[model samples]
Target: MNDRDRAPIDDTRFGAITVRQDGQDRIEVHGEAVPRVTLERDPAAEADPQIAIGTRDRSHLTMRVDGAEVDLLPAKGRLARHSYRVDVEYDGASYRLVPDSVPSSRLTRDGTHLGDFSSDGDETVIAEWREDRELRPADAAIGYALASAFGTGAQPMWMMIADGVSSALP
Candidate 1:
């Protein structure tokens, strides 16, 4: 498949947060210096929560309290919106964690592709491939850096990451 046919990668470091509560209900957040957005939890608010946090720019992160898994969408703003249905087992119960999909238009003005912001079917297929794809750390790092460097409202960062990877490919 051509590079254009692949799902876009977001490498921008919009920001990150590590939360810890000092033996209290309140949570303490830390990360690289950036505007702090609130961590919106599930309605249940159960301990050891499984949560997905999204930003106005379409950046998102899904994390589990017990650290069983953590997925980072560093450049979510560059791609289309799609649903991620995750199953989590906690406290002897299985909770289906399906986050609201971020709209594709909101992510970029490049319009939708087969896997762009509005195609859940395409996103799911690409995600599955990503899990099995053998990508070098350097390639991944370069993709991330390019996305961050070229970010702006006018140009889609995903496209930039794609171009970077394509040019680097043998």
Candidate 2:
């Protein structure tokens, strides 16, 4: 549906956080600030807005916003983990801001490797499912939370998480 009908993101001095429905089962997260970020949303687009992340030559990650694409890249650093950020717009609002640093870790379960990644470093967050499995309790909870926060039906949560992490550069 429209963003106005969804829950409003909490606004802070540094930035604001918002969630809006994309398609029937998709929701988008937007973060924005004055100089560091901007937020926007438009409904007449064909695809959701997106953000791409990686080195100039290698694009390993991406996030789709109101049908557009924004590139996310890591800041220069010697550490194994790097900070990735991007801009996104949807439903008539534009979010042009860098995301906060998210700490990523390698995960493994039952001989299956889930890969190395992290949420936005915020304990209260939701993500989409990527690996092959039915929705886990935690992930399902996240979906429900997101849906409740944005006022939408339950949808995939890991998609947002994967997009947020894969787009980060090493």
Candidate 3:
């Protein structure tokens, strides 16, 4: 953990979030007027296109920024909770998104816990990041998708709570 007590956060700014669902298989992530990352499924024919190939669940997800494509590959993770994971590199830094059974997921980089994000099966999502680390909006969006209904084994908060309540009743 970075020293939060030694010094105030030097730079930990969060881009104002606006996550919009364009269709059944698309999510647009925007900060201010510029788009950060657009996560969606690619047409079967162009899935393994010019971009680098991928692995794991083969969800065929396309990660785009301003209509330009970037590699969004899947990786092996705790599949008992989530279907797959996204392990990518940005600015020479490696990031991993791990999904959970609840409506939330974990974000780690270089084996250090960075943050968590969750979605309530709607356009709005919540992202909490470590105060000392820089925030990457793209990671937040991917984690949100993995925690929301868009990904496998993701259940909403209400459903989990109701299940717990019902299970407890005699």
Error of 3 at 66 (Å): 5.2
Weakest lDDT window of 10 consecutive positions for candidate 3: 2-11
TM-score of each: 0.18, 0.24, 0.57
Displacement of residue 144 (Cα, Å) in model 2 is 20
Please state the error at residue 158 of candidate 3 in Å: 21
Give the per-residue lDDT digits (tens) of candidate 1, residues 101-132: 33221221112111111222111111111333
How close to the true structure is residue 15 of candidate 2, measured as C-alpha lDDT?
31
Give me the overall lDDT of model 2: 0.31
Instruction: Please report the TM-score between candidate 3 and the true structure.
Output: 0.57
- The lDDT leader among the candidates is 3
The residue ranges of model 2 lying beyond 4 angstroms of the native Cα positions read 14-17, 21-71, 74-79, 83-170
- Give the alpha-carbon lDDT of every model: 0.27, 0.31, 0.53
Q: How many clashing residue pairs, candidate 3?
A: 0
Worst 10 contiguous positions by lDDT, candidate 2: 49-58
Ranking by TM-score: 3, 2, 1
lDDT of 1 at 70: 28
